[model samples]
Target chain A: MFFHKYKYGLLQTIRNKELTFWALGFTIILGTLFYAAFGNVYENDDIFEAIPVAVVENVGDDGFMQLLTELSQGEDKMLVVNKTDREKAEELLGNGDVEAIITVDESIALSINSTSDSISVSIVGSIVNEYNTKSALFEEIAKTNPEKLPQAIEAMNVNIDNVIKEHKLTDAPMNPYTDYFYNLIAMGILFGSTFGMTIAINSQGNLSAIAARKCVSPAKKSMSAIADILAAVTIVFACSVITILYVKYVLGVELGDRLGMYILTALFGSIMSVSLGYAVGSVGSIGEKAKGAILLTVTLLGGFLSGLMSHGMRQIVESKVPFINRVNPAAILTDAFFSLTVYPHYDRYIRSIIGMAVITVICTVAGIIMTRRKKYASL
Target chain B: MQAFNLAFKILKKNLGAVCMYFGIFFTMVILMTKFNPTDAFTTTKLTIAVRDLDNTTASQMLVEWIGENHDVAEADFDNEDEMLASLYYKEYDYAITIDKGFSEKLANGETDGLFTVSTSPVSYTTAFFDSQLSSFVSNVNCYVAGGFDVDEAVSKTAQSVTAAADINSLDGNEESPDAFEYYRFLGFVLVVIMISALSAVLMTMFKKEVLARTYCSTVSDTKYVMQVILACSVIALGIWLFIVAVSMVFDPQTVFSRTGVLIIINSFVYMIITVEISVVIALLVKNRSAVDMCSNVIGLGMGFLCGVFVPSFMMDESVLMVGKFLPAFWYNRALEIATSSYEQIYNAKDFATCIGVQLLFIVTLMAAILVVIRSKRQQKSL
Candidate 1:
């Protein structure tokens, strides 16, 4: 009998494409938009490459030439030195093959393309300026005090291990863009609450004409309510899971290695959202549009607090008024995902799960109580 | 005039939704407009773990220099695993280990003894530390090379480093920092308000039952649309004026400037484009739920693509190319001109071009919506 009600509830949800699209389709579309917007930002920020420079070796200063040669010969080479004639070097600079052309005359000079303000140009310019200043100082010191020459030479020759070591807790590199996707999933879960609200309204006889017939049926109010809630959660969870999979596989967003944990968060989040919607729907005799407006305002406020709009907002919230993170359900969901991805342990992850569980239980109980109490005198 | 009176009545009935829209948009505008991401470059201090194995004056000086800007904690770790775990758990943003003989290497003018470990392979903090250490070493070398004694060189170098100033100017006559902030966010505020007000007003006028009654009236369909458009325009203008008035309370320079007046004009053109789009959306959507979803998707999607949320410079070339087809893109282009300096504003060609493009969008969208409405009406008459 429960399965009978559940099947009909599932069919009802499938038929309501408006609710289905907002819960599932809109999120997938937004996720793809976010992916396209932030896909290459992570790689560009973290990756390093050699800056190419054209060298017009006019005056051969043994000391500066040795330093440049040593810097260019390493695995993590500072510059990709292209030793060429003035004309060829000018051609390279004009063609944008190299960032700038360096002429080693009586003094080190750099000619940068006026059109480009690239990072390589800045780097080459700074290096040239530093070399000019240092070499001039060395020449002055050598002329004044012959004794300090050995110490200066030794300082210049000191080999530094310039390395950037990855101390990752997880194998996945941190992509700052993933926060938007995390928030998208959280918003998707809350959007599922609309379906739950619809179901709750449909089950209670006082809410609508169709629900009046359901209330008069012999299938039992508690049984039907439970069946509706279950079916809505199943459909919402399917939508959430499909969104997660699409974002992960097709869009190639790195959610995390813990697929099971991600699924668990989504499951709890879906139940919590549906229960929240049910509670909202069961209490209000308000219009569906008004109820949806309330839910939107609440969820959007929650998303804003959780850093859906900007990445730094979450950190700002964490720094100030941290209790909001503890209370906001969207934040809790994203925090669960964040902890699983960022932390080596599951302490915060488990806390988030417990928080979501508590919310789900309370909302589900409240919805059930509210719907059961509405025993219509004339229905 | 009667149709307009009817539009005003419909708007009055839906005043609550309009208020909610205003409240949300204002809250978002206030919150986001105040945050300058560039301020974080100078103000944000990451916590770094310091393990000073070398107990020398040079190492102590380095630690002191680091402490001036960062929250430094002394971490004693037994193994690499523990260090990695602490970093991964976000106990510290960075870890720096000063090995023994580090001071001796610096004293000898050698560069190789400091080690930094962090969860992030690439970090600004690490780069900052490297630059600071390099500068210190180079300063010492420079003073010694200039024939100064070791102690004098060290003190002179320290003093020179201390005297560095912070002057970061990108260009001359830059927009008032706060003015630019508000101007950039105006796109989002306008999108939200336009969608909410336009959809609410038009949706009420064209509700299935309401439209049937309206069709039964003495007025022709063309006059009805004209009235609806006029009423929406009044509301749009009111919204724009309110925004301008409120913006003036914060940054009068932007609102009162020559560019500001141009922005106001361009905003009105953009509003016409939004009204037509909203009418089309109201006609297409079956219910209030679909209206909400449609408005959100259009408002946010266009705002994001057109440089309201994310700066246009940061957007992918393909996304930008796609944005060119959106009215918001031209709106943002006009906004760019409005926030620019006198030289750019004086020419006014870009402003005219962007506004012209937005006007073109309004005409096209209006024509399309009219056809859709007329066809639907004919089918209903049959």
Candidate 2:
């Protein structure tokens, strides 16, 4: 009887277009949208690129010209120098071809367009400042101590480029924008609460006609409810796996090497979401539409706080009111995925899994208590 | 007249859901504005973490200089995992550790292996910090070679590095950067709210039983359609006015400015385009869930593809090529022009062209809605 109920439960959920659309189709669509949106975020926005600079040499300054050439030659060059006449340099600055113009005169000066990227402008300003500072230091040394002039010049010439060694903390992909995709998958799984709500509505004798008939049968309500919830969990978990695979393979998102662990977290999250809907549905004899609305509010609002619409929102919440992240199921689920991708150790990932389990246990217990022994007055 | 009243009555029934969506989107706009306040020509100040292993005067001076310039925090040097987590979460933009022999090396005028830094992949902040550090170290070494002791060299280096260059901007005119950003994000809010609210009301009015009853009444088809259009216009105008009024309250200086007025007019035109599109969606999709799906797909799809959520400048050229066909693209393009600086060189012709294209979208969608409505009536008559 339990197997029979579970089979029909799966059939019923598959036939429900709305359930399947939110669970299976929405994530794929939103993930593709995210891919399209963040296509060049890392390459164009986050990474440092060489600043384009146009130089107009009014006076012959061999040292400054040599500096520009050296800076512009290497593969990881700092500047892309365009040595042009003043007329062409101004034109390049006006047309936004270069970030700024460096006119070599008695003193180095910078002219930038007002709309240039602030970081690029700052870098250009720093370059000009460094040159002026070095020139002043050399002049001061030559006048005050002629004996050490050559030694000072030699000391300045020692390549100070590699004085600081960079240590990479993780070999994982460091694209912060991938959090949006993780939140997208969590949203799809949370929408499975609707399936859980359907299960609750079907088990209560007062809510649905089919449930009323089942309540009069010899089958135990607890066994039948367990079978239905198990079926919902199975389907929701399957949809999540499909979405994870699609995001990894089809959309080519980097979700770390722990595919099995990701699937496992999804299963736990699916059970928690379904149980949440069941608890909400079992609260009263409120209509199914109202219950669905309640479930959606929980999922989307939780997602919003967890950085679904705006990236870095979760961090903001964590800084402002940490207790929210501790309770928000969406944040917990997203953190589980984030920890798996970012950290080598599993301590944070295990805590998130435990959080999911705690939510699942609380919701399942509450649902059972609500629907344990209820008699309809007029159904 | 009866059709207009009936349309609003149905809308009243769904007002709770509509307002809920409005509240969510309005909160999003407010949060976005708060988190991403834009300014013209402000230098970037990154948050950095430092661990000074050498307790020498030179190392302390270096740490002090970095602290004065940027937000600095002391890191737990023993815990690599904690530092890595902080970097991954962007709590620290870059982490630096002064080597134990940093002071000794500087005393000997050696410029190698003085410090170590950790950073996420592809961080511009790290590169900028590196340049600043290199400049500082080289100045100190030059002073030390000029026969000054370590303490005098540190003070001299500081004085030399403070000699700033003359920085000038070509264009003198300045506009409010925040106004433009707020309006750029308003495109997303307008699309989602207009479509969701309008579709819900229209779907109820276009139900088969409702249509049958309306057809049998004394009202002519043209009169009924005109009344419905009037109702939709009222709703759309109300939403636009509320949003615009909120902007006025938050930023009256920008909202009352000439460019701000133009942005408001641009949003007005885009609102009409959304209304027509929503009507078409209602005529095509039969059920409530179908309407919800269409609104999500269209709202979020366009929001992402266009410049609503992600800046178009950051998007790939191919993605923008596709976005050019969407109405929000033209809307955003107009907003960008209205807030143009010297780099973009504002042109009146370009701004007019953007608004003109949005008008074209409105006209095209209106025709589509008319065609769909006429076909549905013909099928009913057959």
List TM-score (chain A only) for every prediction.
Answer: 0.87, 0.95
**What is the fraction of true interface contacts found in candidate 2?**
0.74
Off by over 4 Å in 2: A375-378, B32-34, B37-39, B173-176, B216-221, B341-343
What C-alpha lDDT, on a 0 to 100 scale, does residue B99 get in candidate 1?
76
Per-model TM against the reference: 0.82, 0.95
Residues A1-379 of candidate 1 have per-residue lDDT tens digits of 9999899989998898988898898998888778756776656433445667788889888876776786588776767889999999877765657766777887777675432323445444445545665665567568877787777666654444452233444555556678888899899888999988898888777678889998777777888888888999999999989988898899988877887888888999999999989988887587877788778876888998887876746656865688888878889998888777766678778989988888888888888777775778996
Interface RMSD of each: 6.7, 2.1
Residues A348-376 of candidate 2: C-alpha lDDT, one tens digit per residue: 89989989989999999999999998776
* Model 2's DockQ score: 0.63
Task: For model 1, name the residue pairs that clash.
Answer: none
Each model's lDDT comes to 0.71, 0.84
CAPRI-style docking class of model 2 based on DockQ:
medium
Candidate 2 C-alpha lDDT tens digits along B274-352: 8888888888998888887888888888888887888776788888888899999899888888777223455789989
Q: RMSD, each candidate, Å?
A: 5.3, 2.3
